[model samples]
Target: MALLTPEDLEDLLNKLRQSNETIKASTGKGITEICEEVYGTRPASQKVAIVPITAGNGIIGNFSSSLLAITEYFGLEGYITDHPDITGYHQAVSDGADILLMADDHMFIAHNLKNGKIAANHICTGVIYSEIASRFIHAGSKDVMVIGLGRVGYAGAEHLVKKGFNVYAYDPNTEFMEKAIEELGVNAYDSADHKKFSMVFEATPNANTISEGMITDRCLISTPGIPCALPAELAENGDIDLVMEPLVIGAAAMLYSVF
Candidate 1:
């Protein structure tokens, strides 16, 4: 996963609105709707606290505030901790926050105090994106390809396999690809085969992983990888419907999953 800078998420509310509209265009569902469907939970009438952790690289600019905005956007009552680190956690608990959202350099997570449910950003992100891809390919299409087998990509491939899609995965790491094949019952993705897919999930931190030849006439890409893997030329085509966002949808997923 790429470390997000404040610049990467500038004017985030408008960005989220655009992403929601794009999703509606492709699948007749918005971000909130898709998350509700995937997690079987709604954000309504929930109280959340954004606790910023100053571990490792310390606090990121606009990170905690962005999380607070996302919570409120989804109809959850949200608050930010006055302090950072462990003191902030206790403050959240003392103030009757049902859900606690926090992140360090290594992990971003949401925890439901009452339910004891923990949601990791990487896993929920993959699952939600995979679910979106599944909705766009209902024409007996099962050849779903997942590009990148890191933490997020692996979680997505597993979810796709569970949903009865014949998952084909590609990662630069041979060990990661082999582990996915052995554990999740997935096949290796062959880019050279010129296999065109109706649904593709891309989660690489790198850019331009999908070239022009990799797409069919009508293809749907659900990507959460920063600096999206699709180039501008391929994305401009009318036949391609893309669903990509930097952080809002993933953070929303983390909250809803444990609510």
Candidate 2:
């Protein structure tokens, strides 16, 4: 993932403004109803809060990931507490937090090859597909490659395949590869090949997985940084036309992007 320049940051802020406006203008159902539709029931209701615990250094690209800051905007209750021996999930449970918006390390970083081709934001649990698919559509890329096959990779890749993006996937996990192809209709490939593509969506957070020069010139890429995926490298490279940050945007939006 690349770093964000002042200009790029401005553009991102503009896109986010637009996105938020669109979100406010368009509405088909209530939040609880939407949650029920996705979770098969209303998310347990509780006063949500953020527990203090530093996510290890693996989550560098990600900054300011606490959902507590936005709880009021979302009509939720919450508090932030630094507590030892408390996982965010369990802490939320302990505090009677029915809805736990845990900070996700998985960040979505995209390098756009074309101007105005991609957008970046943090993806949350709300709407995962909205952010990802919107980036693809915005970039106008037809062929997409997805890296890694963990929970995020699988879901994001499957969503893209279902949306007809000529999705090709590479994962070290053969088991995951087989399941993704067999069950999700994605074209799975070996990770060692490093194929050229119009666009690559990387889900691995390890810095080694996606480094400078990993992609040929003019190829756009998205980095799903581990823990907190940030497009740090992609943003620094002049060749990167645009970058998308998915974790902050919402996981549900990412889920909605493909499927």
Candidate 3:
């Protein structure tokens, strides 16, 4: 996953609201509703604790607070700890938090104490975004295209294949592409292929990979990549409906997965 900067998260609550509306307009469901449908999760009646860890690069500005806001938006009770690291974890357990959320530079995770279930951000992100993309393109679409078969990308590719879509996948790394092909029964997509699909899942960290020529006017793109593959102008122009929010979707997915 691409590391997020503090600037990328400014006014994140408002951005998430707009993103939820964007998703609802396309799929006829909000983020929480989609998460529930994808994960078989319902309204969480558990107390959630967002703990800020001062390890690695230390706390990201507003990460814990943003999680608290997201939890509340999902109609769950949540709060940030008064301290950081282990102390915060102890406080969460002592304060009777049923779910614990924490992150280091390497991974973000959600843990449900009652069920001993854990959800990692990367896997949940892929599954959630792929489901959103699948739902976005309603009918007359049988093939799905996936770019960047990395950790996150591979998970989405696997899910799409299991859903009975002819998943065409590509990555610069031949090993990753081969693994997805052999393991998940996905079709290999090469750069020479000019054909486009009704749904495209962009998970590459690089930008400008999904050019305008590759997408039709009715395409629906679901991307979790930090530097999105599509241009900003096209995402807003009223042509294709694009779903590209950064961390919020993944965080919500993790929460619901463990919920």
TM for every model, in the order presented, reads 0.96, 0.50, 0.94
lDDT of 1 by residue, 1-259 (tens): 4688989778999988877876787778888888888889876587899998888888889888999888888878898999998999999999999999999988999999988999999999999888888778433477788999999999999999999998888898999988999999898978788877778899998999987776677888889988888898888887788888889988888888997
Model 3 C-alpha lDDT per residue in residues 124-221, reported as the tens digit of each score = 98988888777773536778889889878988888888888888888989889788888998888765778777788889889877876667678778
lDDT, residue 11, model 3: 86
Q: List the global CA lDDT of all models.
A: 0.87, 0.46, 0.84
How many collisions per candidate? 0, 52, 0
Give Cα distance to truth, residue 59, candidate 3, Å.
1.1
Candidate 1 ranges with C-alpha deviation above 4 Å? 137-140
**lDDT of candidate 2 over 1-259, digit per residue (tens):** 3432233333333444444433323323322333344435222233544443344433322222334433443444556544522554466555564333333233432212222222223422212432243243224456676777776577668656655677777788899988988997887654467655546666664554554433545554544444333246555655543334433345333222222
**Pairs in clash, predicted candidate 1:** none
Clash count, candidate 3: 0
Candidate 1: residue 242 Cα off by (Å)? 1.4
Best by lDDT: 1
Between 2 and 3, whose TM-score is larger? Answer: 3
Between candidates 1 and 2, name the one with more favorable lDDT.
Answer: 1
